[model samples]
Target: MAIPKRFEESFADITALATRFGENEAAYLSSKYQEAEVRQDFLDKFWLALGWDIYHQEHPNPYEREVKIEKSVMVGDRGKRADYAFYTAPNFLQARFMAEAKKPSRQLENQYDCFQAMRYGWNSNTPLAVLTDFEQFIVLDSRYKPTVERSLSGILEKFHYTEFGDEEAFRKLYYLFSRESVGNNSLEKYVEGLKKAKGKKTAKAAPAVQIQPVGDTFLSELDVHRENLARAFKRSNNELDGEELTEITQRTLDRLVFIRFLEDKLVEPSDIIDRLGKKSGSPWRDFANEIPRLNQVYNGIIFKPHAILDSPNFAPNNKTFDEVLAWLSHKNSAYDFNSIPIHILGSIYERFLGKTIIVSDKRAKVEEKPEVRKAGGVYYTPEYIVRYIVENTIGKLVEGKTPDEIAKMRFADIACGSGSFLLGIFDYLIKYHVDWYSGGARTLLSARLRSSA
Candidate 1:
């Protein structure tokens, strides 16, 4: 049935509810309406303005009939009629939520009483409870769905009943209640779960690939193959010239080996010895020597075959070998300083490691592709990135120095590639420095400090 607009017993009525009583009853209610609860007054006015059919079971008559509220399923049984309940619109004459008004002076620490009143409407999806002392109103819900709010816009969600009438206060309350407003807020877990689900779904929508864990069997064979190749790669041409080569490490075998070289790459022998503090038979002996008996240790491991980009025709670039070595071992692991170019090291990693499979996206990308930038030659450092690093690491150190003086500090790069940013800083300083012993020395000094920093 089509319900009438709010407060209508039927559509033909457009009259004050207070008019239904006799002269004496009307007079008493009229007086009571003026001086009764200010909270009731404000709440009544506010909800009435929102087009609600407002009423009070405890009216002036003191003998009005009691009305029962619909109970919520989740609430099970703790449900009762509230002092007030406002229906959303006439069509939904069913109450959207209920409110229990307390005197402005009533001490109300336990919010469960207020929620119990609203739980009466749980049969319908939107079961809500609100308590007001006029000065403050608290809203509670069994409606698992959370509400969002922002300061710029009061209550980003539709419900702003409690926060209305005072826009500024409402705005602050809006942000105070966000599910993710605080770093350690309890609601953060729920929000994070949703985010992780979305991320997984997005990844699934992109592409996919197979990934079988490469075990020790695979790793051993690969390591043996790598050290064998490294031995050849490192030696002079004359050492390999006269010897009848076996090509025992075939392309197919190398490909299989390359795939796992990264996983089993040995750590520095020196570190193991350092930690053990010098031992005779401790697994440290194999690595503690001049050559670090890596070849024999890995050669003993046999690889069980599996497939993906595995075939006979693989000859790895020299750089890839070093990158894998660098990754498996630390930067300083190789005691020699003048070994090989950093770019070549990165290139080796790009070569043998193989492409990463975007399992969710259903695609595989070659390791040498996009994410890996060769040459280490950056075009420029973006201002925000530079400023952030400067602020955190160097800005405090160089705070008062003139730009000219700051430009000449010494630095070193752990993995410097053509030093583009260093070059950029040099260019910037040349424009500002008024006095310099020589431009080259100033530029070199500027580049040096940046590297170490």
Candidate 2:
């Protein structure tokens, strides 16, 4: 197959990348090529040159162009992982192809490498798979079952980075693995053609691999929760304006999640939300009454609520509140809030909470907050950005300090919306303090609290 006329731009980019790598070969081979992180970085640049969006921030709906890294696929009781999974569309219902990467020191054509790549492809049910280490790329036919006895002989084609300088070799690479070729089903077709040329009857392709689901994407679940709670709260209380209803709903979700987190962390007894579950009776009513007592017992220590029991939002008649409670409880979802990363939770809230409900003509309508939309539509400051800011400021200030000494330092964020920056700093301190004290710091911190008491 010939390279398309449109390949001119990509060809230039590939040439430039090859030249750059060739010039830095000595330093890279000695150090960077052996390190997993450094090799991953180079792979990102390599794909970027081939038109994949490595950062995933350029597109309006980043999922369309996103190259998901370290995508987990459960092989059995344990999870197996691939370095990159290329989805043709954003919903990730089907993976068009999969790519497994290795350190530059590893040979892409090695039997073990081929076996590993084939396993991921077969598990994912992708028709085409690529194994690469920035230096060598081997595209394989994953539709056939790959066996341990003969792994290296099952490949379609292999190419070296040095070969990109040869027009014929570059054309072969473009035909088998270019973004356009993969997107348009050309690569699958090429694999099929190779089988036909070898006088092999086209075996019916195996069923698409039922790859493990990504486990209820956090943002999708959060969005559904937000919409349902807003609707339920409004249905239960008709007198409140849209803004009031939104505030009440947001606060309710936040408080419940916060308590759930505490329970998971062992800071609170497990199953605090379970106290609300009932087979028959006014469970919501009972739950509402218990909040005041709870506030009296643990208010300032955990969180202080503003008369939650008195609000119509907490009324037992709002049976939908039971649904929300059940959703947050362990029986309804697999999420273990204790172990789930805090940044994932923070980012979801940051994005979903940027919209407010408006009551007009006695009907509620949800829209993005005007100021937030004007500023750029509720984009969560990516974790890397927050990391950079916090490391330079808070990290530098707190270094070489004790937990007690750190306690004396006061910090403020004037524009702490969903508190991603502040939350990051809090997480940082928690980790640093725990590391500093190792085994006994929690005991000490608890004692310090008791002394203050």
Candidate 3:
């Protein structure tokens, strides 16, 4: 159903859509409506979508039947099954038009439409006959008495705005069909707005959409984290100015999200941290151990940095900030700069993580690392997949980390196979740089990155 173009000014006042068969609707409704369980369900959805109810008087000729027009041109041909034939007086008005409803998959074409609808409408003395495949509804009307030609279908016809299979039909029907109705224009505009809103516009994720407070404690922590971040950036980047740095920090906090892969559990800081420390010993310990190993191999760098300024990337002023930012950018530009958030490691080794794969490889040729299991199986963790997981999980990852925190971020697969995780080592390294260079404002910086995504 192509949307009707209601006169913008009057659209609000009339609140009705302009209903046209061919110019607006790309397709028409089919008249053959028969009862088959599958067809009924399909038609039911179609009927409701088109604003016609079973209880209404102008309902299609039959409840459900796959009927062939008894006497018509296309006789002896197969007919489509439908739930109802509906007509409305106008837009949201009386049954001025009649239609036959069918399941969504039926395409309106040279089938039983002419044969069935002409006979049905001729017998009922109705002005319009319909053929519809829930997505696209067709409208067939009498040219003289018995002659209703093909109106809307295919291309080359000037009347192009016809959309019978979409939400646009309702908009048109209200405006065109009910010229006398009040607020016709308003309804049309409303429908248009609905369609527009429904359209895939660049919906800037509502300021990184703060989820409802699961608990005040987390909220408090989040707030403190953000505030501290703002202060840190303001303190470090005096060149960028206070307000600008503060703004960046706030944005970073907003983007902060804590995600957990576990099913049926509210993600909490303790989960990741606990798991990381629980080396088989403890999962958390295993993860912690894993991070350093990965860091050494992928980034050729180690953080286990206890001192705030121990890492050369840390900056307190202009000279240091420039160097830090440069290093950050350079590291990220590399093919394998796994950027792990600094605070994330200390907050909880469990979150903001880059994981290794534990699968068997097909060839089993390479020397298997500690975390990699090797045998006979297609178990190579592709870099793209690992990168996607870490980037996607960043939201939840930040929830557990804090500034001035750098613990060994690691991912250990108890059944490490082909070391699919090693592929993501670059991500872990880059995250480390990003978190440090962000000036403790992971939330805001993350937002800028996500918007580009």
Which lDDT values do the candidates have, in the order given? 0.34, 0.64, 0.34
lDDT of 2 by residue, 396-421 (tens): 88766778899899888898876888
Instruction: Indicate whether candidate 2 or candidate 3 has the larger TM-score.
Output: 2
Q: Residues 214-239, candidate 1, lDDT per residue (tens digit)?
A: 22223333445544443443242222
* Model 3 C-alpha lDDT per residue in residues 8-32, reported as the tens digit of each score: 4333322222233333232333334
Off by over 4 Å in 2: 1-216, 275-280, 300-319, 397-409, 426-453
lDDT of 2 at 314: 59
Provide backbone clash counts, one per model.
23, 1, 110
Give the Cα error of residue 20 in candidate 2, in Å.
51
* Shift in Å, residue 262, candidate 1: 75
Best by TM-score: 2
Q: How far is candidate 1 from the true structure (C-alpha RMSD, Å)?
A: 28.9
How far in Å is the alpha carbon of 35 misplaced in model 1? Answer: 12
Question: What TM-score against the true fold does each predicted structure earn?
Answer: 0.22, 0.45, 0.23
TM-score of 1: 0.22
Kindly report which residue stretches of model 1 are placed more than 4 angstroms away from their true locations once superposed: 1-40, 53-80, 89-93, 121-125, 144-165, 170-453
- Lowest summed lDDT across 10 adjacent residues in model 2 is found at 207-216
